[model samples]
Target: MRFFLEFLEFLENMQLMLIINTIMKMPTVTKIIYRLKDEGLLDTRICDNDNRVTQVSLTEQGWTMVEKINEIASLLLTDSFTGLKPNDIKKLNEYLKILKANLQ
Candidate 1:
């Protein structure tokens, strides 16, 4: 889950270690990365300036998947709030923003 979200956050190529640090588990992150590469949704290469550093980026297919995932997430949120009033939704949005800011 963290891996997917990080991929969305960093759409361009990013250093492999940076991603691992964000997710906070090298073995698990490495496994997921290998699986994504096997699925042809991600690409990785060694950085030219630093042989010890590897870079990762999403493939075209991964971008398409991200779009679909976002669409589904939006639809799910709308459906979940179907019975809520407009003002209630607005309040909920405001509260969520506050909570997110606090987290940051």
Candidate 2:
């Protein structure tokens, strides 16, 4: 769910193939996309230029949901880190970046 929302955030519209490539899995991506569509949070259609390609974009409801999700995430993070000092947070962020890079 987070993956789908974050991916849609940067790209206004994405091809289903691109989503599959990004996720490195077709079945999971297809399932999530279809679920979102069924919930009326995503809009999908076959590309006019290429019938074989499907494109997906977020609906207005999806945008609203994303905003709400972000707000909740922010609050959660703030609460979780309430006892941490600024320097502690900065160091944690630096370590997280290194960990992310190592994983990549």
* lDDT leader: 2
Stretches of candidate 2 exceeding 4 Å from the true structure:
14-16, 94-104
C-alpha local distance difference test of each model: 0.75, 0.83
lDDT of 1 by residue, 1-104 (tens): 53464464564644547746775687777777788889887788888998877677878887777777778888998899999999999999999999999999
lDDT of 2 by residue, 1-104 (tens): 87677668777654446646775687777888899989989999888898877788899999998998899989998899999999999999999999999999
TM-score of 1: 0.71
Residue range with the least summed lDDT across 10 consecutive positions in model 2: 11-20
User: In model 1, how large is the Cα lDDT of residue 76?
Assistant: 93
Best by TM-score: 2
How much lDDT does candidate 2 score?
Answer: 0.83
- Extract clashing residue pairs from model 1: none
Alpha-carbon shift of residue 7 in model 2 (angstroms) = 1.8
Candidate 2 residue 70 C-alpha distance from true site, Å: 0.8
